[model samples]
Target: MALLDAQAIHPITLPDGTVYRDTVYLKNVIDHPRMEIGNFSYYTHSGRREDTALILAPYLGHACRERLVIGKFVQIARGSYFITSSANHPMAGFTTYPFRIFKPETFGYKDLPIKDTIVDHDVWIGQNAAIMPGVHIGSGAIVAAASVVTRDVPPYAVVGGNPASIIRMRYSSDVIDELLGLAWWDWPLDRIEANLPALSSGDMTALRRA
Candidate 1:
């Protein structure tokens, strides 16, 4: 009923026995109140929660402190994580030590410039991928598994590898434009259910009619 809080890893099964979504935990690690997540999104800890034996195990929103807006129909695979601007510690100083962190006098969140991380509609961030802060992922983009995204991703781009780059665009510019125009994700639940067949079949004619 709301964005994820401290209680993460909630899975709801539909009448067809399909796993609706495993997430709702966006509020847990993010310090910003403006951060928002949408319906049917899976964003949370997986089996790694109990793996206390792993050394320095990773977690979602480990470096978060500011805005992170996720759009509807976004699929965030298990173990996927976000690296916020807070992780960008000052490494230019004489010593790469964060003295301010230990010293309360200068200790504050403003030490680093915070930038909002936005994931637009229909995005699929693969397992263990790291989305750095300030990254504006365009709609329909796909981030490959374990890839570390360091820049903005274009809409419908299929990107992978460390410091993620554009592997390919999912569709031609025209088709992409049409799909964006359709924006089925924004439609009401009843409309979506009514048009599910057309949507699943990628029927542009049916979509347009809807």
Candidate 2:
């Protein structure tokens, strides 16, 4: 049998074969119009399956202009949530208070700049991490626990702390470029399984050969 099942709502199976219900494949569980989740991207949350989208991105409404795009093989730990562009008030004005929202006719903030939050392939976001509006997390980046990401994270970087900053790059520029070019996440399931040794060991030569 294949190890991964994209259609499974609860993706994680324990060593004893019991399904771990807290972990859900985002693509299968989320059906929000404003959210785009790639295959095998899972989030660990205690919320009901139907509320996965809402729990992941509370501010992203169906009518909202901003999108939350999460790529393949992304692992989001418990308590992590995305704060999208819709959460922002009018910062251009003197008062941040949204006076226009009270009136039903003028509720929309169409003038506010909207930018999609993008989490690229193979990113692992640690527990309690908060991804702020408009941040683009590059492929293979690792976001540390309880971090507040306010800026763009570079490819294969290890970022941590409030207003997350890059602590270190996982690989040298050349290697990162090569791995990005490889894009193993895009491979077919059989091919991916065949390259497990190279993937797990970070064997560039073997990956290239594969």
lDDT of 2: 0.95
Give candidate 1's error at residue 200 in angstroms: 1.8
* TM-score, every prediction: 0.77, 0.98
Candidate 2 lDDT over 16-93, as tens digits, reads 999999999999978888999999999998989999999999999999999999999999999999999999999997
Off by over 4 Å in 2: none
lDDT of 1 by residue, 1-210 (tens): 332222444544568977555443343333334457766555645444233111112222434466668887788777777765666677666876777778778765465677877899889989889888789999999999999999999998999998899999988999899989888888876778788889778787888999
Model 2 RMSD in Å is: 0.8
**After TM-score superposition, what is the CA distance of residue 70 in candidate 2 from its true location, in Å?**
0.5
- Indicate which candidate wins on TM-score: 2
lDDT of each: 0.70, 0.95
Which candidate's lDDT is highest? Answer: 2
Model 1 stretches astray by more than 4 angstroms = 1-34, 47-65, 109-111
RMSD of 1: 5.6
